[model samples]
Target chain A: MSATIHFTIDGVEVTGKAGQTILQAASEAGIYIPRLCAHKDLTPHGSCRVCTVMVNGRPQAACTQPVSDGAIVENETAEIKELRRNLVEMLFVEGNHYCMFCEKSGNCELQALAYRLGIQAPRYPYFFPQRALDATHPDIFIDHNRCILCGRCVRASKELDGKNVFQFIGRGAHKRVGFNAPDGLGHTDAAVSDRFVSICPVGAILKKRVGYAIPVGQRLFDKRPIGSEIEARRAKGK
Target chain B: MSTKPKVATTSLAGCFGCHMSLLDIDDRILKLIELVDFNKSPINDIKKFTDRCLVGIIEGGCSNEENVHVLQDFRKHCDVIIALGDCATMGGLPAMRNHVPLKECLEEAYLKGPTVYNPGGKVPGDAELPLILDKVYPCQEVVKVDLFLPGCPPPADTIWQALVALLNNKPLELPYELIKYD
Candidate 1:
């Protein structure tokens, strides 16, 4: 920590150390800034714009944008909330998210975020795009239908797990997660024990045969909305 | 002739789970009946709409010609159309077949499926049967839905809150606890 960098998130004064991103700073300050793709253990890829914040009137991804001294950050505004909701909806329509039958139903970050945003139904039409499921890996599987292209798994694998197991291939709408090995995930160095295996915010990547273990009401985000724990920190004190 | 606002409901390409959830309101059913008259709802076994309805609660999506026609009729006769449940709002489970071709789906369902016992090896192509669309579509794609109450089947409490608000002509703002997808 170089020095204490103080900032205002939504007009509430918060402080952080040097080199800390707005998200990390806000998380410490107990101000819940909604995000996906930017995990604590992973490098901030900023692919999912769910955590976009206004830094002195400029829209920036909070995860990637480092905190500066006396910076004016707007986390929750009517306009920002609307943009986040729309971005989340795009992620919904862009994939084949059959949440009713999905194993990640309650624990899924995507679903929890949608609920937190009060999005009963997305305004846009469902694309219902064609996607595939890769179950070649005996321990873990990838369902492209639920992938938000957030790059969390990619970052986690390379930066944390130290294995170049996952990578994105193709262009634009055709872009999807591909493996390092010529063969399927089973052929790759990816393992069930990899940190990337547990880093997926959505159910796109899941471990084999362990789904629905937590039960319905006991799952995360079931009792309370996402970010409650972070906000609870603020309620406790400064 | 009751002065109460009339409400009509129908299940299209749905499993009637939403309707079941509506009934799951339990004792509130009496309150709901007191508040609104059943115009064309199956609950009252009324086949035809004898009068214009205040609210038309749609239970599912349009997977066929009949569903489309029924939704169109709702739009015509009802002042407000509420798309109730995931099926009506997002095409729900039936939409899983959207990625596959219609021919393949038909063959899988009517002929090639493991449980199929079609000795005639014939797809049901009767003139009376409604023709299935290429893919299931949400209600909003076909008609203007005034509101959407999403869930597999929105909880009974959720239904009660929404219906009460809608009936009272109040701005619908559901508490976070009442809203859920599954």
Candidate 2:
């Protein structure tokens, strides 16, 4: 017999099996925590900090922090919302995110989260850093301008596909995603069918010849706001 | 003089797609006419502002001295300035040029490449031409934008709703469908 863990998120009692993280349990319980780096198929990485929740009055990443009996989790409070907004805004200004022309505009998780957080415009000054595009690969391309360095592609490439093609280079502002080969993506053994291809949360990693295929006003986030599906599932659970 | 609220609009270093989208409001423009008066706008073909405007709607980013001058003029003569498209909000497509040096861009366009018919074509240095800025800048970076309506071109219904709300002195109510970044 498996042990069960009980927790309260925003005062709502939720239950989960033992050895589940707060994010996993909350998600199965129909609660939504905004996240960027954590995906269902891959192991949890608490790099983005967008899913930081108060666990027993201390801040911890919900994705990495394991749930325990009688733990009080605060996911949606004013302080957390404002912190998330600032983090989101910083991500915007840090990248050359020209969302208007991006192929991932409506479908991008970052843009959807910005809308979900009510970010009309970034409060910080735009860096407008000069970044390069890698069109060397025939099937796929990488635009460094839009990358947030959440390490999704690196993790997916290494763990899921077992290709180990993507890795992080440098540190801080100079840090960026790099391919295994020195000549760029063309020389790398990455395939279009790799799991990393679809795991990107933004327009940084894109497949060729599919730009604007779905058309505007009809993408995933266009039909419904982010977290609405989970919230809908929560409503249905009652 | 008519007591209707006066509004003006302009497009800087942008495609006039936003203005076209404004026309996309269909017959709702008639309701807009009843609500506000067009002052200096391409719709009215008014060359310049002759009177103070209650609202100034600007589309596109500033890429040259003339765009800056026009934006400043609007700021001088208008009470509220609205950055009315993605270009005006974040430099948009025109900002793609920010990666390359302006001199290289000008040389490629005028002196080199396949498009130039004249072999000795010189860069246009006419005294009458507006001097280009080193890089394109969003409207907010250049001026104090009172409001921003972001999209490649914000949908016409979104424009209509914002216009109506501004004219009625109410907070603009943006529904999910109307608030798209692209």
Candidates' C-alpha lDDT: 0.92, 0.90
Q: Write the per-residue lDDT of candidate 1 for residues A1-238, one digit (tens) a residue.
A: 3899998999999999999999999998899999998898877888888999999999999999999998999988999999999999999888988888888889999999999999989999999999988888999999999999999888888899888999999989899999998778989988899999888989999999998898777888877999999999999885
Q: Pick the candidate with the highest lDDT.
A: 1
| Per-model DockQ | 0.81, 0.60
- CA error at residue B66 for candidate 1, angstroms: 0.3
lDDT of 1 at A177: 92
Specify the highest-TM-score model's number.
1
Query: Clashing residue pairs in candidate 2, if any?
Result: none
Per-residue lDDT of B52-155 in model 2, one digit per residue for the tens?
Answer: 99999999999999999999999999999989888898888998888889999898888786777756578888989999999999888888989888887889
TM-score (0 to 1) for chain A, all models?
0.97, 0.98
TM-score, per-candidate, Cα-based: 0.97, 0.95
Error of 1 at B26 (Å): 1.0
Could you tell me how far off, in angstroms, the CA of residue A152 lies in candidate 2 after the best superposition?
Answer: 0.6
The per-residue C-alpha lDDT of model 2 at residue A203 equals 96
Worst 10 residues of 1 chain A by lDDT: A214-223
